[model samples]
Target: MSGEAAPALGVLRRREFRLLFSAQAVSVLGDRMVAVALAFAVLEIGGSVADVGLVLAAGTFPLVATVLVGGVVADRVSRRAVMVAADLVRVASQGAMAALLIAGVAEVWMLALLAAVAGAATGFFGPASTGLLPEVVLAEQLQPANALRASAVSAGEILGPILAGVLVAAAGAGWAIAVDAVTFAVSAACLLALRVTPRAREQQSAFAVDLRAGWDAFRSRRWVWTFVAYFSLVNLLWGAWGTLGPIVAEQDLGGAAAWGAILTAMGVGALAGSLLAARVRPSRPLLLAAFTDSLFALPLAFLAATSSVPLIACGAFLAGAGMALTISIWESTLQRHIPGESLSRVSSYDWFGSLAFYPLGLAIWGPIAAAIGVGTSLWLSFGMAAAMTLALLSVPDIRRLPVAPPVAGEATP
Candidate 1:
């Protein structure tokens, strides 16, 4: 909450953090390309908008189903080992998809199946990666480290779509996906080169018992649930944007290119926001974060209420900014507040709760849109997201989340 700028660049200069950053950056590029290729591949194979929905939902479901287990694994096993395994699994799965497409034998089911597998790996990877950050960087640098990651992700999102558009148009989606698979391999290599020591596992238990212990951590925290409940509602609304927004773009807004622009603008905004977050920490971290989430729905309101490119772009930018701010605060709070041993498990619970309804939102939004209208669906999403933000901000615990004092030992966790 201090006005002084945090030394974000100084943290990046640390050798171990640099390695982690490099690996994450490489992996993010591949991740973004997968999104681009998946959407295009569905369209190329004569799949409907509904098929796209199914593919995306399939990809996201693993996070909801496996996150808790992933957390337990992160807490019990070496975080580096878990990350290495995840990267390898992604490489194999993505490579198979590329080969299938190259053979001209690709099917929607294959795409969906591969996506699900990759998602499961990511479910584990996300928690481990998040939990591992404090181990690699100074406690005071947590916000900046997270900001750098957000910027990297935004950079990938911005470039991947444009690259995929061009690559799929010229070389085919299969080749584009192959490029993504290669990036994963490179990411693994970067991670393997890290020099940091893994945290010693002081206490161990059966996996089932550890799972229950993680649950206990969640049950003990009021702020944790307040954040999770609000995000659950926010993510449900996002599911509508994810499932229907692209279809609306193709049919009503403009086309794939238009959607790409909208998304790219948001990515750029996210990068800007991340950079801003590195220097500015909010006093009311949760309140600011939840309130900013409402901006995500602004574009929906604009698109639903009227058709204007500039307005939509504006809304998307604001939403992206909000997302960027929220990520930094949320990650820092979780790292600082939760017991390091139980951090990943608590994170898994947060992930599961926040995203549990996303697929449901995606699945139901299509039918709801068909029944009433896409515009009406947009209106409904706007209202829902706004309501969730308000409800989250109204919680006394959310408004009172404690910022942990700086650790007195070495900056490393």
Candidate 2:
């Protein structure tokens, strides 16, 4: 390797990257814990499977609706400021939910409202986080930087759910959610410590004009939109899995702890995948990413077919690994190809498209499972994931897009 090419840990040595990484790591752990705690919380309040779906949908709908505006705002302001503000918003929302749950006054509508607030924060955070990475690391270090971020997220997933499951068992979901609220506070503190370069000011323009420009940039890239379209369907399947998987675990597999184990296994696999992605550079990045993404179908199929935790864990592991690898490549590609000024906006479009049907899936999965059986619903979700991936591969751009050549000072892969 050329001396200029970053060693695996090289990016972490940078002060700004370290701060950013630490902030994200803590926040991700909290988010994972919340994922488990919230599901069980809804159920604990005499909620049915459909209730879980509705609560999740209520949260996600706002994210889907306002993400483009969030993107525009992120691009306009300091990314770090945007992230810090977003973190604080989540803290308030999660903290309120925790208070309500602990006091035994958390109605379904109350939970949904708090979740919507948190989701609105996420709409801003997601785009800013996507745009922030390139600013903190060198071009040559993008892969490792992305990998490290993914690794932090994976680590959080691995530990957070297990702890959350235990906490929920021991102290109730309220306490677990309370812990999530605190972590967001810590994340905001870390974000406040970072000193990133200021983004170039854009020419003042109408909001509609800026939105149109972002949309134009997104549509101009065939590969970007193609994969985004594919992911919309894939995310729909994921939404179903997210909504129903816990219920299945509770009913058949072994309850919250069993579901936690499955997620932990997935996180372990994702960690390994991120480590591998750091060192490997594929010639056909999108092609490989598309193939890796198809692995997500495995867990859904396994969940539908069997109630064995060990077997389901195996499938979840592969799915998580696939998702991590795909995310690393996809993020690096966007950073390399898209201009920084418009990166967040374009990323917002990508998020908007990819997540457009996610809330619908979350809303519908319970009813679908009820009507056609949980197993049938899962099987259909898996089938759709597989089909969408195959269809994505059929596109010339996705099949043929090559990884960008290394920068002049960097070693060729």
Candidate 3:
């Protein structure tokens, strides 16, 4: 709403970017909502907590396993076609889940199996999306476009769970999941409407060679790889906060509603940061993003030091804003620096690295917390992450990185 930010909205005038933006917004809304619906659905079928974990992991493991292949396929074919196909696949998977649940015959195994299918589709969708966006807009529009997209995701993060909860409460988990299925259909329709040409690239290489090229692209960039390495560890440490914070909430603060309020505050902060990202362009983008991202420690500190929900929520808000700025700038940096041909593949590598250790993080933090106590564990995680981030800042590659100059015309190199 600020005068400065109004200019960022200009990216929406581009017809292709607008349509892509809309598609991503709706799809993310569904994706976030389904996370809530799926867990509840497991319980609805008399499944235990372990079954919920199993179903969730089933979705994720497939995504990690197939994402590289998805990236290669995105590079070889039409990114739009890949995205539309992914969305349609999700429609099938989610719709089937909805149908099964509504019929009162859905089992934990059935939901788990269908979730794997949806996750596999997302594996393809993720990279194709990264590759396709650059094709549709002027290179200069990348930040604003990414920010707008982040805002949509942030909106989804805030509203999706709430929506799913309401629908589940009123109509049942089946209806909530059915709404998610409808969203994918909407995204598929939007993807089908877009008109853009992918940049030409040689596609005759064998699949192994293509995969190797992607790895080469990723490894060659010292900054990109190093950044990914730093986050891998940081995400690992964040598990402490995630594992311990909820326990603190239940014992000290009120409970689930309080935690939800804290999370909503974080989401609101992310939305605010997305707006700021739209307006401000940084010279040392990566460095600034890194600094903002390290602010995650703020929430960890709040959780360690206090039982006050308002104070802790404030810290959570700052952490969320930092995440928004980091993501918008980082996505723009990748699209700008990485070639269009290998962009998806390189992005898949980034995704793989970032996500690879998070499961481990989630697994280990609980035992660690049990051994040392939650408060000590949170503070330790916070301190270690801060020290590690400080070391990451000392790397010359991150400090010296510059924004890519704007493209001469509409096409990306």
Candidate 4:
């Protein structure tokens, strides 16, 4: 391969991996598109500000509740089948939403209900996705596969909102959402085309038994659980940025446009980092990942210190890169270290832990800023997030996990 060629090119050249990768890229675009459009859709329907929060929460809570179950299901059956089913369910939910909105018959309640259903399906699709790559690619390909996927996600974050904004302006939120629904259908079609390495099943165990096993698997891995613990705290603490950043931007920076620029910088950084992750082979994977994750503290710190849009945007960019790099390495780590048979189940716990505090973080931070000044609150949140990452780095195992083995022996990707 040429030095300039993406390491992912080799992985993407394979038929099955290409299908899976295409499916991910398309679906992520849809996911990002709907994220922007959904709020506007609710507003277009004459929803109250409270109704907007309600509708979003309605979607988010179900995904959190059911992701574990989805993980268990993915483990028991084909990961491909699990993803296809989840995509179909999302297709139905998003498609219904688009239809109702386009028909001008959509209600706040209807959007919330459908969002909940789609969220539940998303809970399933996510873990299955992390589990599926090992089924399609070689062991050495896991890093590139995951990095390429992250790149797709980063690109979607940048473009999806732009597309949604344009569509909402030119046509309506309904049209943008309809495009999202189409992406899901496209994902389902691609998933249906995949030929994966199949696993032999033993007699199925009870659901509770399977869930317990997954929990055990997660809790047993110190590196996994420890970092998840770190994320659980930091993700919540970082919520302050999400809650306070906008308020600060409006007060100090130029407002929405400035905030949007900051976000766009972050997305660009993520794209850059993911591309780097594809090519850079770290000696201590977990350690590098963990250190990179500390950059997450930047936006909060910069926002706390100054109102300068350029400085804050710079921080946001690095933070976005840090986030993309962390996740790419983390996903690769999970796929390489964890046993394949129960990978989805274990991944569910990871997802569950990481997200568990997010809503609470978002909810509490605004109130906190109301009590203290936004700067004080932001600084505190930054301190906490930085401390968590530092404490996580102190752990020995984070530095222990090595690069991929030169050859696959017992471990087949």
Give lDDT for model 4: 0.83
Q: Write model 1 residue lDDT over 1-413, tens digit each, in one string.
A: 34444387778788888888888887877777766677778777887767877888888898689888999998888787788889999999999999998888998999989988988988888888888888899788898898888888888777776777677767788988898899889888888887667678776688899999999899788888878887887787887787777777777767666776777777777888787778777776776777766677877787786666677878878878878877887888788778889999999999999889887776677777878888888899998787777777788877865466336672311
After superposing candidate 2 on the true structure, give the runs of residues whose Cα lies further than 4 Å from its correct spot: 1-6, 405-413
Give stretches of model 4 more than 4 Å off.
1-6, 40-53, 99-110, 169-172, 241-260, 303-309, 369-376, 404-413
Judge candidate 4 at residue 260 and give its lDDT.
56
Per-model TM-score, in order, reads 0.93, 0.96, 0.87, 0.88
lDDT of 4 by residue, 69-135 (tens): 9999999988899899989898889889999999999999999899989988989988998888898
**Model 4 vs. true fold: TM:** 0.88
Candidate 1 Cα RMSD after full superposition onto the native fold (Å): 3.4
* Top candidate (TM-score): 2
Residue range with the least summed lDDT across 10 consecutive positions in model 1: 404-413
The C-alpha RMSD of each candidate to the native structure, in angstroms, is: 3.4, 3.0, 3.8, 3.5
- Model 4 root mean square deviation, Cα atoms: 3.5
| Total clashes for model 3 | 0
Error of 4 at 379 (Å): 3.3
